[model samples]
Target: MFSRFVAWAKRNLPTRESMEANRWLRPVAHRVLEPSLWRFTRRSVPRGVALGMVTGILCPVAQVPLSAIFALPVRANIPVAALTTFITNPFTTPPLWVAAYWIGSRILHFGEGMGVEADAARGWMEWLFSEAGPSLVVGLTLITLVFAVVGYGASALGWRWWIVRKWRARAEARAA
Candidate 1:
């Protein structure tokens, strides 16, 4: 039943060329990312996921750059690093940002009166820009750093366990 669904999904999916450049870009991505993935995979899935997630969140622009790091050991690294998307994907991004803001506010006492809303942070920032420029910058910087560290550490631990367990299973299968 699942196989039939998979086959149907594959058949209905758009052609490779019809997809966006990023879709078919994995080959190049693999070339660049394999090394990093390989090195990180040596640690474990949780570690790799943590590294990837932190990298992705801290500097979204660096996703490709970080992926290149993982691409080195294509087999182990890709899967582990790809797990980073658990934290970095589109759906989770906004929530993460909000959380970062809340954390920042708690630590800095800047947003106490503002309450938490999707746009509230932005409004707070805008107000800060006009009213407290240095404080805003400092707050944002601190928030970004905190989230990055937390994301990396948590993901790494979780991914490490996952990767190790998976590898062990594979090893047992091969031995069998």
Candidate 2:
């Protein structure tokens, strides 16, 4: 399973050479193609996951590039960060936004005074501008932060678990 995942990742994810050849990234290719940022170390992977979560949730477009840009400063695993941005795609975005709007409304209580009738009278655009807009923004911000923290912690724990499992299997093989 892990080998399959590695194969898939290699086929799909961008390489250092591809990134370096990118017209937009060419100017900063030196920094972006740094060897340390590309390594799948314990420290870098979690940071990459966190950065990817943040960029994936907050950015509407160019999430891969954005994740890469964010990864530069943090010394994150660039490929992992770029791959993680797939969390927020076309199929998932609508539901995610709806949930964000719901959460934001619950937190802000923005709908307390405004009735459906009043909203209808004002028009959907007006209602969105007055109520839904801020709620969505706040909710998205909250979701992004939560995702980042959770992604980082989860990835770190997962990495540790994988390493331990591998060691245990190796020990069993040696004993046998």
Top candidate (lDDT): 2
**Shift of residue 86 alpha carbon in model 1, Å:** 4.5
lDDT (0-100) at residue 46 of candidate 1? 46
Cα lDDT tens digits for candidate 2, 1-176: 99998899999888988877889878888898899999999999999999998899899999998898889888999998998998999899999999999999999898788777876688778878888999999999999999999999999999999999999999999999
TM-score of each: 0.44, 0.90
The residue pairs that clash in candidate 2, if any, are none
